[model samples]
Target chain A: MESDQYYLMRTLKVDLGERSYPIFIGQGLLDQGLMAPYIKGKQVLIVTNETIAPLYLERLISSLPNSLTVDHVVLPDGEQYKNIDQINTIFDALLEKRHNRTTTLVALGGGVIGDMTGFAAACYQRGVDFIQVPTTLLSQVDSSVGGKTGVNHPKGKNMIGAFHQPQCVVIDTDVLNTLAERELSAGMAEVIKYGLIYDEAFLCYLEDHIDGLMGLQPDLLEQAIYRSCEVKAEVVAQDEREAGIRAWLNLGHTFGHAIEAEQGYGAWLHGEAVGAGTMMAADLSCRLGWISESDVKRVESILAAANLPIYPPEQMTSVQFKEHMAVDKKVLDGSIRLVLLKEIGKATVTADFPVELFEQTLSAGDKLGKFI
Target chain B: MESDQYYLMRTLKVDLGERSYPIFIGQGLLDQGLMAPYIKGKQVLIVTNETIAPLYLERLISSLPNSLTVDHVVLPDGEQYKNIDQINTIFDALLEKRHNRTTTLVALGGGVIGDMTGFAAACYQRGVDFIQVPTTLLSQVDSSVGGKTGVNHPKGKNMIGAFHQPQCVVIDTDVLNTLAERELSAGMAEVIKYGLIYDEAFLCYLEDHIDGLMGLQPDLLEQAIYRSCEVKAEVVAQDEREAGIRAWLNLGHTFGHAIEAEQGYGAWLHGEAVGAGTMMAADLSCRLGWISESDVKRVESILAAANLPIYPPEQMTSVQFKEHMAVDKKVLDGSIRLVLLKEIGKATVTADFPVELFEQTLSAGDKLGKFI
Candidate 1:
């Protein structure tokens, strides 16, 4: 049965013209030889975190062809460790090993690992090839597919980074078997985001399968990941640089980044913050009369079903959100532009929204879905 | 008379399609309102070093349209200060001042400041618009025109960086008056390189006008800078990513980088090392029967006339050169590729040359131009 699941593997391409690459989704992709073709050089450096090294490092290494020389650098896990110092460690390893410009970096962990490795490849010798082997649900569904690679700043999230795409993304659904329940919930938030922003049918599907996905039902999980990546790939292809429609991907990210920044990164897993931030966006959408209060409740219920947060942390104030959001990459000319839903599956990035209502949303706290 | 010199301004475009930008060369371009059109935003962060801030920062500020908000960060000068910490200082200033995505960073110094600032602009907020206002002669003719921006690592020169083009480059020849003589000589090395690598006519032009250029005579200086930039702009336009002909621009860079890395960055200015490295390359080319011994002497003579070094530093050994060259960005699959001359005005990037001749050239030292 497990072998049959391998035969059911799916592949998608991110059409970035010359920079285009494929994303492979399946069970046990690590051992399936999917990675061999995308690697452009004879040398490989696998960048993973300490938490993930013991789990799959050897499996990933043994899967590569014997002709290639491979090395690994295990970074400390967590968002706080994502900084320039850690990036230097990757550089140090590459230099110490004498990895040349043709070396390919394989990111072998979750989003943090993918981000740091992709960024290191982006700037290593002023750019090299990198492959994404995203092990966690959050990374597989969102971060891995897009070329958004960066580390966090003490004051902001992803403040320093580059738009460097990976040569290919290897997503093995079986890796989710080891993911913590909280992380599983976190990944669901982005999965749900695709539904909210681009597909009402996907949202409906998630609503129907939320429980099975939470329980790690492989088929349900694969469907959710495949659809989410499809939406992400479509959006990224249309607006790779985020000059237009790509901003839609940040549906709740502006508010979510503020929450993550306020409480400190890693205090709230990115998706949890997005879970609540999406509710806040939906609430504001309700206020704008673009969506009904019931629609806001629907967003709350879907997120709640996924075991994600539906409200900002009680300790965070509107002033803190304002402070953090002002520094967001999305902000332009000092005005904090946000992605708000015009309908259940439609969104717009706008700064034309009323200031008073935004201020009210910031202070709304637990009463987000109530139209009072 | 000064106003007439301003009318002699030359404008060239780096034709990179969407990433295309212009290079403006002349005397006192800062005061001519050449910068206003290139700045994409209302906020400007002028990043200059202490040395340049005193000389041209205020003048640069006064030249900007008063409607724009301008800020400045003065970093300590020299190549040693070019690293991640200094890049953070630029980030700190931008975030502290609340500069948004629309803010444009202005790099207003020589290679070190321009490199760090352009890199900061490349990574800050995951990339932003920047304008290059190169002050030193070397930068105006070379670094400022190309989109190659980075800072050196302890293990290597420019080990970490990005390929980020600027909105435009504003070169003011008058700034060279305050430039130290050694720095002017260093700039001449690259000027001579334009002659050696791409144009025999330009090489002969430098041969004839070497004294006037060294003395910083305005007309000769302008012509040298113009022709040098024209070659650089042409090469960069053909190979923006350095995957092809762009590597030809590194004529002396492999051996030069080895010298720079061994002596520690800033011990020998980059062009000084290149001056000697180019001599070594010419020697090896002679050994390859690609060029005659007299041709190597011409290289030595032109470099000597510019007050640049024609030999590697005394303490550097062949082994150290081998060690450092092994880590060069040009090295592919562990083989150190060098840009060697085919003739007086042509160069090729190759790892196919004889190893013995390369070793002999490394140990040649003061005997670089002598045939045996």
Candidate 2:
């Protein structure tokens, strides 16, 4: 692994008709001059949290000129803090500083900080400009590239939010070294998903070079992040506000949020919980005979090799899980619609699932931790 | 006049792909069985102030079925209450009640209450479904239909907010009959704005029947309310949020807010100040040769007949007025955009007004009243 490397940057264009923006991905994006021209004014709020604050806040803040009157609100780190209360802290600090409508909020952390700050900026003074500076692997791979910003509630994750785009995104791979081993493995769960949902060949890439991805290999890491963001960007660009097909992006989120909410936030890192939920979904798909048992085994093996959680912990009963799934943002009119495996490279969302199979899958996840 | 008459029963259909909602008007829209479907099973927060609570709170509460759980928070009424401290009241009430992402907020009152409630709902849990139960005519015609929710700061009015759409709107026009003459007249200023901006025929109607509108003539009132809502609905449907062209609806707001924020809020009613501001805008438009002097005169006579203030009170100097305008939400890249007149039935936004003319208008308005 080389310390200094060149990476290709791609742009995620959120198609809001006239109100579109480019989510630029590349190394050294922060040090570029593109930000100031797009940014409308002097005031900016670089919203990060305790975990990522000490590491990247100073470097990013310094990258901005003195003319850019910048300040930051370091929120309590993690998915647990991605709610209205923490979002309010950003609003409070902004108001105290008299940062008006022209003020832009720069998100400088993972999905939690990006979602929370983007939401804060989206609703602050009706709406303001926001720039994404995603640091963590899960965010860079998927969450940070799209124009989606929101907060979690005790009841569910990302239940409340708006479809707000960032002026630009600055994703630097250097930050991934600070990520823990569990976090890295957890991120692979989603990396595996793009391949499962859209590209089988990409799935082969992860399977062949799992070690390089896990060992902070910069070139491999850049390729993974760039491709994942490209897929997400294309999907979101076609549907910015999740009206019709955009809901497909919630491939594992419906089950994932239920596990996280039921277990209490931060009990399982979002990626880990999602990793488990995705496997459970695969198993459920197998039970329904939508995908062959061989496909389910392949997904389980790949995730297991990466050390990702492939099942729910014990005590996550099927009944409570079903009820939680009903409250998912993607769930409409009391019935839950879910993304199910059709093949290794394709998935579909349906409210038309067999009751017994759905129940069986939830209970299967309930026994997962015990088996682990 | 018919005994079964309702003044505010109109709808705004915004065509922003899928983020569109209908704004319902008419007296007793809540009790008319229209809101139940939208509000069903969702946790609801009814945000009202001390002044509006005793007046309409119980009526709204009883209107909802037992299927829904309801919580209420009341703040003191006035523009001073529109800030982060006041905004946190909604957050505190939400977290305390364990309301989550699926919760719905009902903003029950005048412009101040409606704006604050909508802004609160916009930021609460990062965004939620909020219904504008606008009790004031000003809000019914202007604020409620547009999905513009936000609060005021010491520096400006509506300086922060998001364009969050309501699940539904429940307007009870009968509530206006109980309103004080002053309040009703204050609201009439906004009512008159629609006529001035896009509907000169409506302006002519107001000119001919000022007394009928004032006396609460049901047939005439319903027509006025519906037509105002019709124009607003069309504008908002075309431009859900003020990105490029939707801002034409903010004809008098820029100047109006400067007056309201600078005068310490309680000093002037929102409608009264806006009423005067519209006249100032007309005068400015004429001075900048955007419209003729006769058009300015036509604007004044209509407002004067309705007993709305036709002149900016001479308390603030040109410098003071400019200082207040500096923080306006509509200002972008240091230039302020003004919705000026082309003729009686047309208007255009221009940021290229002559500085001397802007100063002259304040001086012109100063001789009429001692603002400074």
Candidate 3:
């Protein structure tokens, strides 16, 4: 075991003061026995989806100490299935199994699994402890790091939720080998977002190595995920409850969430909606003279090269977008505040932007899909 | 107005450092226009029960600034209605009214209304501000002061909740004038608990003034409410999350919750269960030699004078008590940790008590209801 191997398995902290925890990212990190210290009690409930349970659940359980009592609840996969019904199922299992407050809930899947499981942990016994075992590229970079845990309501995305941080986040990069290629690219959208929101240099690196990242070149993927987590962790540390700069992370999410809610949650992958939504935000920012038109093109090029959407579903009209975003959780008072890029690296949450430009951005896109 | 009149309307602070807020206990605090400053937004959603809305809702609304947009949701009154479904109803109203993150939720009833409304505010847009306007004696003394907010699941009482502090708590002493006799007695149970858990002198005061409190003498009742809030505020200030000394607050809750869950919530008022539950705990303490049998008798005498139950329901046997309590949220790992009195003024949370002694205590109680 060399020092570089240990360096490759990097530990990043989401510094939320007393509630802070570390994120362990690298290949075969689960098998390296990293999860045991975070497991505070005798009982561990591994909450995973049906899709990932067979592939990685056993490997996770095998890594834990043999003396630990473990049970699992396999939820049906996909974002469409993430709802209060599934949460009820998790609660029912905990009660039936008699898992007490001391039980640690381990979420093993993608963002849906992590969000729902985190919420279940937050609500159970007024809250118990939970650990995130993110398996998807998107979750590894975004959802698994922030303390935002929730399920979408029919009226809006993440309408019912809580800000419950996890005990630790374990990112096993090896698991990405099993993810579908389309899902892989969808995740790159969030990866690209980290650069778009805060790191111009990282954006340049993505542009330079887009091909390698798309191909799942381990080194490139690791760098992208690590840098993305670092950016997210920094923003979250400043504003754990989104009182200020933290909302910058939702650069494309306001428009993206509207698309997901209108199309139904699963029709478009979260990152796909985000990719198209990011393009809209860029166009709006360009119209506002916050960024040059070329910068918008550069964003489109990166997302396009990564095989992501640059437009929402053609069926959604600007009226629908406005209505959906109106009820968005981020809407303070009655105005929908948006995160708009001032340049490649800087983003701002503001309500000062023109409404017509937003409408133009929403109306500008046509139906199209790309694959890496 | 005399100094005594001013004393009747005392404002006590729950010192939680930055999250600290005042608990206003007085006859006409609501009409004094105290709630306006605490309400942060133009919109206020007053969540009250059908039973309470007609009694005091209009008075509350009239006290708010006329420029503010005010709405009320009248839920059917009962502990049974405090669940996720009701939470959804609150959500629906918020959405339908297009209440944004800036909207404030006002809980305008007793514990059930306060807990459910506070939870609604907590889950709405991740969280919104809420104020506690406790109308019952129980709420004025206990639940309204603490930030513990959640709906109940069929499996347990308050099984699904969060620790969301309210902006402020307004206790209109006059509202107790409309409370039913049983409800007032139930509130007295909590009032007595304050003395039992942390203040022996307060317990002695309670013993001396049981007649005045039960008779609803204005000065005596105001004094009791003020002191109970003080004890609760101190406990919560030290341990807001029930990590240690705060567990003492659950002195009767573990056993009380089981009774509420088994009998079905609302079949017995929460304080009614606590009344009997506290006696059971006191008896257990007596058997353990932590407190004398005479001390236990004194506890019984105080509760009896306040018109509360001192034993479990006739239908509930020791086995049922064991089974229901096994699933209590406070059961860490597999052990049921109980908050027991070392003496009337001192309480400790421990799993060290003998199991058979607990069972014997459960079986020792007779089915008798007491009235002042």
Candidate 4:
């Protein structure tokens, strides 16, 4: 789907040759009057959930030209339903109605629906076309932009899927009206991720306007999504297939996926699980003497105020966590490569830490009560 | 996953950046002894069907490094089982065993299993390492090498999947010993496809040794497979995503997928369906004033001798056929592009043809009575 996307200027990119596209950021992209040329297709599949579908489905569909036949598939809202069974519901609906390859599937919800819908499109007749209309701040910044799509397995989340790119990404800041206070707070964790891993300047901006973001201020939310996507897009362009630098994107995900799988999907929001995982990552780095206590606390302080968990899941045993660690994508030659803090805004991937100490930190940290 | 691959001379590249690898095709590739160097991880998921596992799995597995954990998931034999729900069985098994992202999936059967298993790997955690071990002539020649992996939907065959590349492809010509005569004949259709579309020399070879191939002549099968892989691998290298030229591979699939979807899966092997579809394509070319009378008959005569069908199922009405066409991948702007033969060794993809007359020829040419 060769789309001429007008994304915020960024350093990273998702280079898949003819399929390569940029994730545009900045306000009012739907009103920019530039994306109409790339958006073509007599029929469109605007896939969302009951929660986000009714709120923004009309605006997103109206943004398209009247020549298009926009169809919608609203799913149940939550990460728990992001499984193969749930994804098949989409397949059943598409096939029953006779959806074809050229038909576009626009994912219009949080991380759960976006990932599941994108994966469905990837597998529909070896793949069709799709777009992303992320409503939640978490999706606007992270899940909704990347081509990585899949559903959770009983053993693991995102255990089944493919790398299918979206034709275009339409992020309407106005959709944030439906987002709960807890949802907004949870999404802030990923916003902090971009700064911790890529842009230090963006981190400082969050620190300054942390109050406005906590309240779901439209201007602040848009800026964060734009910057986060810019950083993500740049990284993706250079490493479309996650062979090298793209591994950096999994900074806290290895620990996060483990916690998500262990605690069960929807028990804690993805952002919250990731928030806790990020805290564990900073602690591990401190134990390994990679970063000082101040930087770790700075990371912890941000997550704590955002109402995100700052410790690992208390229900998980060290052995359970260890078993989960073995499945991480970053591990090579049976060794786990961790993306840990070298400073407040810098991180490095390393496998030199003591295994016993790492496990000890994970166990001890989880023993602590939930974030205050 | 980059290995020292020795094809004739070219670099069989997969455009998925660092995840890409060359597909080796030559005599005695199994003994050339390059698998241990390329295949990573100690644990492997060797997926094959009951028909193929007994013939050559021992030889191929023994040749590999002993340090590997090669567990096998044997499926029942047939194209009927290559569906979305069936493919999920593989994922459930992999996840139930706690198989991680680093685990390699070895597809050890023909196109049905290769497509299903490769697709399973593709969706398993958004993708895992996969190696294609094609046993049937059809798979060895085509499906085993290319990165296309998916399962069939009830509405259509291969209606769900992704463009996932295998870590490496292992084609052991020794497994054709157990292939049924009907299957061997069905496989020749694809073998002939490479020649009709790209390599005329290979087509001449098939014409020269029809009986020899039917008798399971080792040298002839190897020559056919090697040549077809060479042509297919070359095409894959040029257009990995099937954007333009790679799509030329689906010469008869536009009609074939519909027939298979209409008649149910196992009732017609994929190759048998393609064989019939190819005949219809030749006739369509004749109707369009593109191919000679004998050229159309030549395709029909040889396919008939090989015990393959030259017509589709008779029960399908024009409307039913058109309804099936709704899900074909070639449809764009709400029109299905039919790939018809311009001559014996040439084909063209166009949507400008008349549909009413085409349906009449298809309905008049039903040959399901022979198989059903």
Candidate 5:
């Protein structure tokens, strides 16, 4: 890939009437003076974690206009730190520096940073403007588009949050060059999800190029990120509040959240758990006769090709999954709603699947990918 | 007032387009099965503080339909307890009880409970339905009409919050009979505010019926609550986000929040501080040549009639007031914008006011009520 081709920028709009915003995708877009247009105020507070601060915080800050008053809060890294206490730290910094209602918050790291900063923006002075600068593959492909911002409770993942959209999303694909190989595979789980749930053609494209995508080929990565965001932006525009089709986007999240909560929040990466949980949903879908064994195997292959987990943790029991899944945001009354495949590229959220099949899938563990 | 007259219920709508909801004000509305229609789900969580639980919790629980599952979390009573920890307690109860997205949270206490419950409902599962069963006069007339909800941050009053509207507001005027003398007086401060900011006719009504309203006369109290909510609903409908005229609703809050934060929350009831803050605002407006000495005296007379303070805490200094006012939500850039009177019934939010007048008002202290 030529260096000049890497600079080609792709922008997509998540249309939600007055709340609509653009997602800018390219290499080195962070330093190209693209964020100034989206920032609504003179004061900007960049919220990043410890790891990303040393790498990209300075680059992001120096790129802004000197006339803007820019400050930042460095949070402790990891999913474990994404709680109310850490969120309060961001609020504390904003108040201490006396950032007024017109101040804008810039999220400068991965999904955890984005989630916390977005939530802080949602609540600070009863909502303020925030821009998402996602640094990781998982965030770039998934969290960057949807306005779902929140912190996890000890009992549930994203149990506390709000539907607050960003002023804009800036995806600098170059940052993924520094991402760990495991983290890259984690993001690919969501990348493959777009194909499995909404677009068979995209799934086929991912299948044909999964190797190059995982290898961090800039063109393939950009294509994957842009396509993923496009699918997400479309779905979000249709259901900004998750009152309808938006639940389809949570194809693996209910099961994934159960894994995260049962094992403790940081035990597995969010995308890793989703990778395994997608296989669980596929298994149940096959058991419900909505999809064939071959389709389940295809789901397993794509996840495996990205070096992602295909099963829950060894110590996790069926009862633990049931307990954690009971509190999922998708649950209504006492019924657990699972987002399952009707076929590759088609998904539905339903509470109508038989109980025994769900129990069997929960007990399947390592045998989940098998065609029994 | 005839016994039959007390049975008449008045309902008003807070029109925020799709987010609009009704405020139902009556003597015995809480036990009359009015909230059943507004609750969206079969699960209900009644969030009330300790002081109110024993008084009204059972009555509220029994008032709901038998088919619905009901749970209640009693929080410790007071402004000091209004923080993230208490909010987390509400979250813990909801999660422990396995409340789902379809569940409705009923705020069954005063402004503190209403704010915290509405905030919890706003964030729980990214948003859920809630009914505000405001048991205090202040909440019924003020918070019930506006969607503003949040807990207080130590650095500032109501520093952490969201603008999540309720499903409905059920005001049971009968509950005021159980309210303490000081509490009733606190509620009066807000009632007086409505007359001061938007309606001279109402201010004249308040001045004429001041003793009867403070005495909790059913006819006078009901009229005051209904008219207060009416004015608030109109203002909120015009500007739901406080971007424009809605800031006028906070006529004395800029200075009141300073008094509340400086003296420590719960020291002075929100309305008492507002009483004094209104005096301070009137003083500043007078010094700015917007109102007369007699107008300021009229403000003092009404506040004193309601048994509210007309001056800041004796220990509070000008520096403390300035420090606290600097963080008020109305502050833009580096300027402190205040909602002040242009006349007895008209109010305006401005940052362009003369600095000397503001300084003089802050330093006035006890002398604020006695104009030169």
Candidate 6:
């Protein structure tokens, strides 16, 4: 059984020259003795939140080398708590424990825990090595694979952050079995995004496997995650700093961020925001003649099947959308540059889209269910 | 005329591949139309402190392209204020004004302001372009050269920071004419450090031209700043993250940081602490038989001539020194690594030095004046 577990392990590389690292995918990876080599020092500081700590913290501790000294900082679980205040807690634990530059921080939770832990590692002692043990499907498929580490700002989501990559990413599909159904659906949104932006067949596969993914089938989930990681890895390797093609990764993020920011961060899971936001993007793309109306219906149907939101929140208005998006990092000079789909598996980052079409989509986005 | 300032400009390059940037040193770079090309967008946020805004901020503003929209966030002036609180003030200004990723933040002040601004830029929008308009001798010669940007933590100096390089460094030496004599002396400590670590010839130049530098002779001051930047640039280019040889730059900083942390930041100017700390490092080096006692004395004399401190504070005990040094970023695992001089112009980073010798130096460090 042990040998079979090890045999199931697959690795994907994110080629960032000297800073490149690997993402390991499998079941039972947390128990397979995989974390020791990546941890270079004698000291380890695992940062997880209250919810995740009770689930996998003990299991993670048992897997580490016995001789290594270990400590943990348990943060409050939620997106609202992901801020500079929480980061200070990690810094306090490290300094109080006298953990030095050689210390390795393990981010062992979902996107919130991983982001805060990765950021803490990035800032602690001017940067220490860290490994990602993503527990949520959202983090495994999206946040954990990218080097984008940051905390949310009141005005925007992920407004304050850094581009510090982890030493390695350890993705164990078994952890997703315990994830909340809402969280599981949220993760599928990003998984579907990879296919929408880069791989058409992958999108079709996700459409077919939505039920299997929702049930947390190990093989189906692992394949989906592996494919999603491959897509992000290719984009990040080409533009480590998000100078050009990397901006494509922000496909639904412009609308998603506005939703998360306006409704308060934790009220809506990041993926729920992205799911609805992607539908809005598709609608805008169709209006621009890049994607057809039928294509938009197909995108909406897939997201609906995954039980993800396919429309903007009722309270959100066109003015509010524009107001929130104006503060986005994607806004260059005074113009908001958006990532819109050209067709299935194709996207373009542009500021040339018509304002009338965008305004029309914003006014009509929440009513897309009637057309579907 | 005005052309002389442009003609006299000296540009030094920090070659870190794609992150490489130039440092321009001259008399009136602010007024010489040097910063416009580097400003990527119409929005420019100039982060200056209270002490510097009245003096050079106006000149910098006038020099910027008129079409550019520029705003200023002047923080309180002091090392004590160089924390997350002040960094938040920059973030507040940027978010309130809706400054996006394309915005360029110009850090115009002493080392404290430059460090905070660079850090703010590093965190704002996950990293934005920042230009260093270093006005202090300490900043122009040292802090502004490498990509080292951060605020100080109460437990340790520079405990919280990121290795975010500036887009360009603009050093206007003319501003130093208004700098206090005390500040000038603080700047010399770093200037003397370059000679101690990398170039014996430069040490001789500083020793011979001490009067010209003290008097703020534009050419002499500019030459010293240029050479110091060159040495720092070379070291940083090879080790941008301070994983190895770059630690040599901390020759005086380890001891200096302990002093600053114990006394509280801003109580002792960073260079003053560094000056006294260098004497301690020299004493420890002599105890290790790495440098002769006379060489230690020579190092002290140069610092004394620059009107800088040559002894650790009297209030600090050897135990207190150890306590603070224990929390330093350089304390790898449990071992305290010190950068020791091999000779007047050579240094090495090692943990092999005798603890008894280090203790002896710490106990007798403040009493070195009697020996000299």
Q: For model 5, name the residue pairs that clash.
A: none
lDDT of 1 at B150: 92
| Per-residue lDDT of model 6, residues A1-372, tens digit only | 246543588999889888889999998887676878889999999999999899889989988888899999999999999999999889889888889888999999999998988888888877998999999999998899778999987777787888889989999999887889899989989998999999999998988888988888889988999999999999888888888888888888899988888898889999999999899889889989998888999998899989999898987888888888898888987888899999999988999988998888888864555322
Write the candidate numbers in order of decreasing DockQ.
5, 1, 6, 3, 4, 2
Candidate 6 at residue B303, lDDT? 96
lDDT of each: 0.89, 0.77, 0.87, 0.75, 0.89, 0.88
TM-score of model 4's chain A: 0.90
Query: Looking at model 4 chain B, which ten-residue stretch has the lowest summed lDDT?
Result: B6-15
Candidate 1 residue spans exceeding 4 A from truth: A1-6, A366-372, B1-6, B366-372
iRMS of candidate 5, one decimal?
0.7
Q: Write the per-residue lDDT of candidate 2 for residues B1-372, one digit (tens) a residue.
A: 235855445555545566667766665565565677777346888999888899888978887877788999998888778876777788778766667667888888887888888877776645677887888878777778877777765555666677777877776778888777878888788778888778888888888888998898866776788888888877777776566557777777788878877788878888998888888888888887767777787888788877888877677667777777776777765677788766776777888888888788778777784221
Task: Kindly list the per-residue Cα lDDT of model 5 for residues A1-372, writing each as its tens digit.
Answer: 224544679889889899989999988788877888888789999999999999999999998989899999999999999899998999999999999898999999999999999999999999999999999999998887889999988877888988899999999889998998988988999999999899999999999999898888888888999999999888888888887888889889899998888878888999999999999999899999999999999998999999999988877888989988888888887899999999999999999988999898898863443432
Give the local distance difference test score of model 6: 0.88
Tens-place lDDT per residue, model 1, B1-372, is: 235543668888889999999888887677777889888789999999989888888888988998999999999999999998999999889888888778899999999888888999898878999999999998988889888899888888999999999999988888899999999999999999999999999999889988888887888888888899989989988888888899999999999998898888889999999999898999899999999989988998899998998889877778989988888888888788999999989999899988989888877773444433
Would you list the clashing residue pairs of candidate 6?
none
- Give each prediction's root-mean-square deviation over alpha carbons: 2.0, 5.0, 3.1, 4.6, 2.5, 1.9
Model 6 Cα shift for residue A103 (angstroms): 1.0
Worst 10 residues of 3 chain B by lDDT: B363-372
lDDT of 5 by residue, B1-372 (tens): 224434778888888899988888878887888899888788999999989999999988988899999999999999999899999999999999989888999999999999999999999989999999998888888877788999988787788889999988888889999999898988899988988899999999999999888888888988999999999888888988888988888888889999998888998899898888899989899999999999998999999999998888887888999888888888898889999999988999889987887888888874443433
TM-score of 6: 0.97
Please identify model 5 stretches exceeding 4 Å from their true place: A1-6, A366-372, B1-6, B366-370
TM-score for each model: 0.97, 0.82, 0.95, 0.89, 0.97, 0.97
Superposed Cα RMSD, model 6: 1.9
